[model samples]
Target chain A: MSIKNEILKIEHLHKAFGENVILKDFDLSVKSGEVIVIIGPSGCGKSTLLRCINGLEDIQSGKIYVDEQPVIQGSKDLYEIRQKIGMVFQSYDLFPHMTVLQNITLAPMKVQKRKKEKVEKEAIELLSRVGLADKKDSFPRQLSGGQKQRVAIVRALCMHPEIMLFDEVTAALDPEMVHEVLQTMLELAQSGKTMLIVTHEMSFARAIADRILFLDEGELIEEAPPEEFFTSPKTDRAKKFLQTFEYSKK
Target chain B: MNWNVIREYLPLYIEALGLTVKIGWLGIILSIALGLVCALILYFKVPLLQVIIKIYIELFRNTPLLVQLFFLYFGLPKLGIRITAQTCGILGLTLIGGSYMTETFRSGLSAIDSIQSESALSLGMKKHQVFFYVILPQAISISIPGFMANIIFLLKETSVFSAISLMDLMFTAKDLIGLEYKTIEALFLLVVFYLIMLLPVSLLGTYIERRVRYAAYGD
Candidate 1:
């Protein structure tokens, strides 16, 4: 655990929709290059947590810091914080109108105002990193689900984000396609990209995560190294959770 | 069956057809602009503009185009501001066409997932950039069919401009009838003129709709 210097910190965060409180007094801190994976049942606010960190959802009350810069609710510009953070959704949400190359180059060229030729060169390099260099001219519709998600990862990486948030990036893939997408993520994690992932893939989580956070119904129930969490979970909820996977596997 | 009269009036009919096409094309362009502005304002839920837009959409959509045309052509003159009949025609079509176009665009905008904007925002893009880059293209793709269909409706509705004496195709037919007493030939040629104008536009709309649908929905 050579982790030092926190990259993200959330304190006393509260989020809700109407009378239904989704997250309450939740807090977390992550160090640079720490691959934190979040596991939870459906509707347990796992995705909500990632969205809050990225400023997709406005927290009811709390403070979030990215490298000590506070993400204030309305006053601070989210663009500054978001530029360093990239998010990939379950659906890929690729801009269908854009070619793979254009999708990768858009935010960098448009928002960052980088020169087109330079950004496009970087985009091509990222596409090759994801093994999709030949698919640059293809529209999203032309790609299979696995290829689309891979391209999506490349699209985010083109922006040169310091941190990445992945919300079930492989959940929608066919069983055969899931591996390809996960392989891209595995390589990304190995490259030391700080990531906060909400996923159901236990095996992948075990392989890459530095720390695993178990959330149950809007509360952090357990946080441990993946080895310890898998072998000896501290809470009954986490035990039952691991049991379900065990039962499913058997 | 008055062939000679129709032949004699060919130039007048052509002139009227040209006027109708000019007014129709200009009005459609203006409406597209107005509709986009109004739709964006409503989509963003601008505090005051939201209520005003709702009233505007409801008002124009509910009432007849004739009433709207007359109001623009005749009603404004009574208020001591006189505009040309042609201006009234274009403005009337723009207002009415704009209302319908707004609704079409609204549906298109709503069809997109809010997550799309969220994704763009999380990528460090500004709100306007999110709109221009992420949302507007998708919205336009989905809205084109509806917008094109509305253009045909707007084209036919230009007949109402004749009420304000703007001398559109319908106006020429009516005038030629009065002069030559060849009502059937005049009216028949008018129908042919409208069909000639409308058929190509309708075909182009269908072609574009198919292409856009394939791009957006992958169907």
Candidate 2:
């Protein structure tokens, strides 16, 4: 494989809410087309890290560089920076008032000022890609949970973002619905989209991640190829963590 | 009790109804505008303006509309601020109605979940765009029921315009009674006209509430 350029870099990040420190001195970097899965126990800053990258949450004392541009909260360029990063949430927060096509086409036409015809055409294509073409005119209340999640993915993808952030996207789905959402994500990963995923689905993480990052207590405890990390985790924390998944699987 | 007296006053009652509706509509529009502005200010916490709006809401909401109309019409002229009684009626109604509207809109805005805004922002929308395109629509939908109630309340409040001598419905009734002592006829006409003015609005509110609820929740 040819060498890829780094697209995202986080250095010496510190984030806290009031007196509670969530992330301390956290550092990470991702190259183009790299799929990084962040796996950790709850409250370990997995979701917070993604939020910081998207400029949703403010950081205390660190810098995040996306495509060499700083992601500063309240900056004039933050809107431009956010256009390059697409984020999908766990709750699939589709705007309840708008139909699926309206929800998907809203930002591209309004924020980016793209042509309505072009944006609608592109939205329909993406919807078909997610197998939701027939449901385009339906409101969010009409769709099933898995279908809403897929439509949300199409909403994010409609921006043509350079990097996509998935924050526990399938954690809220029913058991049968999780597969469809995960399958859509797997296809996205296969298409070489740079993705940072925070998930509790160990098997899905192992299947799609180029590198698996183990985080505990807001620290990067270990990083390795998925095969190595799953087979022979270096730290006792990783070992114990993987064992819980193993026990749950049985 | 006298059908002849009611028949004799029909034209006068019609003219009074027209004036009452005109004033009611003007008051409703102005109060909604004022209320929306104050609500947005408070919702976004616009520095010093938010503090002023809070005081304005408390003052207007606590005081009776009658007192407010008296002050605007009777008291302001003594201070060299001579607005017409018509202006006083509309202005006073707006002041009190605006405060109620502000609370109504504020509750609507607050009821929207933060995640909705977050979703819009993450899609690369600016703060204002998020507010206009995403937040405001949902907020307005959530606020339809309250907005309708405020409209009806403002219309009812228009009856108090007679206190300022603006020739509204109540003034027409009181004038007819004082002139001819047709207490039953005048009061009966007043009741009928008020129902005519307010019934459609009340019914429209219910219709809109149902439509908005169905669109939002499919219920």
Candidate 3:
């Protein structure tokens, strides 16, 4: 296997909301085109870790480097650094007042100073890629939950970021709607986009992850290839965690 | 009650209607501009300006427009700050109307979900870009109802301009009554003209509110 360039690195990160510590001494590294899936119980800091990497949350200690540039909260270059990172939220927070094409093209045109025609052309293509070509002129409120999430993914992708972060993107969708979004993500992974995803969709995580990481209580308890991690978790914590999914399936 | 008296005074009332409309809308526009600035200051919590704006909003909102006009028209001159009654009416309306507008806009700004901004910021938008592109449009949409209410309130408040001797609709009605002792005719004309000025605004507000709702929700 060829050694790819590292695109993201985090070391000894600590984050807290007053006395409630969310992430403690966490570290992660991602090479170009790697797809990492983080799985854990609710409140295990999976979301916070992703938020920290994107400079949305202030870190109490340690450093995060994206393409060797430090991700510092409130720093002068945070906006520039953020352009290199794309994030899709669970809420599908599309601008309700804007059409799907406008929502996808806004950041590129306004922030990146890209030409409106070029950005709109790219946005329409991305919308088509997500099976939303006919809906580009539609407002967000006019779309279903699954369609909205796909538009959000296209919105982030328009930035051409170095890495993409998904924070439980499918968790809020209807059960049937979940597959369409997950399928879009699968195609994104197949295209070799570097991604960090936090999800409770165990099967999807297992299928897409280059490596699966098991986190509990703000710490990484286990890390392994998806097949190995699913079959024989290193920690009893992970084993018990995987069992919850089994019980749910029954 | 007296058609001939009303007919004799109709032209004066029409002239007063024009002045009232001009002054009322000028004030409304200025107030909206002032309100938006004050609201942005409060929304961003811009240090000393926020504190100053809070006091200004409280001062104007708590006082009646009548008293504010009196101060600007009557009191200011005693202190050597003489302004035309027209200017006084517009300024006073701007001050009081601005305060209400600020609160209206502030509520609209706060009503937006934090997730909207979080989504924008993560898209690599600068803070101001997030506000102007994402936050402000939604906030303005949310504020429409309150803003229209404020406009009607300010327009009606123009009735108080007569107290400062601006010859608005109310002043014309009173002046006609005093001159000819035809109180019913003059008062009836006053009511008709005020309605003529305000009904369109009310209807327009409803129309705009419906359009904004449809655009936002597709309902």
Candidate 4:
């Protein structure tokens, strides 16, 4: 594969909620087809960073670029920017009133103005890809946590985004359900889709992340290749954070 | 004891039942519309209007429905707004029922997970799309039971319309009692007519509530 240019970039991002600063001068660059995993302690601004990139949350001061277009503040055209990025949330926020098929086809049919038949065909294929073909007619509540998360992923994928952001997508699942969601993500990573994942699953991160970003106290403390970050973390906070997983496994 | 009197007054009672149903149905529909508007204004926190809605909800809810009916029926005519008694009854029921409907919808809107809206927005859906397609549907689903309960309550509230001489079921029964002096037969027939009117409404509400829940959970 050829070397790819940056598909997403964030610079000097500052975010705060009610006098409590969440991110300070945060910077990140994501190249096309690169998989980056962000790991940090809870409330360390990991999810906030994902939210900012997608414009789900506003920043105190910063710039986020998707495909060389600057994010327009509170602009109606922001949907143009958002369409290029697909995001899966921690809680798998599928539209409960809709079937799995409806959930997947909603944006395509409504925003993209695609033919319902075409989107339905594409949705079915995507569902089949995620082992959820049988669940196309089912509602979100009918599915288990892992099934719901996988459907959430496919729902984003239906938009044909150039980049995907996963914000601790497996954090809410049962222990047994986590593996299925991780496996679906691993398949997407191997397919060369650019991904930004925020997760605590160290082993999955090690397997997929091109670079692992360690955020601490609202700052990116270290960024390293997954192999090096796991083998010998450069910062004490990263070391201590990793050790919690290590002890749990032991 | 007064079977002959009951038979004689059947047509009048039936006419009154027809008027009551018409007014009750109109009251429920208007209240739902007004309630949704009030709830949406409050939910979006529109400036100036939200406070007005708050006052409207509180003022109507705090006072007695009879006082409101009396004002609309008698006092409004004193101000030269001479509408019919039936119109006054509907307006009265709507004002009171709408207040409770607003509360029901507000609670339902709150029950929705905020992430549902965020997820829709992140998918590139416009603000209105996020509301109509995502937020409103879920909010309505969560609040359907409450909505049904309010409708049933409003249906029963139509009994108060008799005080305004609207010729509703209650008024007809009162007239029958006055004519025949058979209070037991009049009250008995009145209870049966109310049961006939309200049972179908309650059953329909339950059916819709079940479907909404099923759509929400698929179970």
Considering every candidate listed, which one attains the maximal TM-score? 4
Name the candidate, 1 or 3, with the larger TM-score value: 3
Local distance difference test, each candidate: 0.89, 0.92, 0.93, 0.91
The residue-level lDDT of candidate 2 at B71 comes to: 79
Docking class of 3: medium
Interface RMSD for all numbered candidates: 2.0, 1.3, 1.1, 0.8
Candidate 2: interface RMSD equals: 1.3
User: Candidate 4: how large is its RMSD?
Assistant: 1.9
After TM-score superposition, the amount by which residue B81's alpha carbon in candidate 3 deviates from its true location, in angstroms, is 2.5
At residue A102, what lDDT does model 3 achieve? Answer: 90
DockQ of each: 0.62, 0.67, 0.74, 0.82
TM-score of each: 0.92, 0.94, 0.94, 0.96
User: Over the stretch B108-199, how does candidate 1's per-residue lDDT look in tens digits?
Assistant: 99998987888788888888899988999999998898999899999999997888888889999988889878889998999999999999
Candidate 4 residue-wise lDDT, B101-203, digit = tens: 9999998888888899989988899989988998888898889888988988888888888889888999888887888688998998899899999999899
Error of 1 at B69 (Å): 2.5
Report how far off residue B1 is in candidate 2 (Å): 3.0
Per-residue accuracy of model 3 over B127-208 as CA lDDT, tens digit each: 9999999899889889999999999999999999999888999999888888878989999999999999999999999999
| Candidate 1 share of real interface contacts | 0.72
Q: Clashing pairs in model 1?
A: none
Query: What is model 2's native contact fraction?
Result: 0.73
Superposed on the true interface residues, model 3 gives a C-alpha RMSD in angstroms of: 1.1
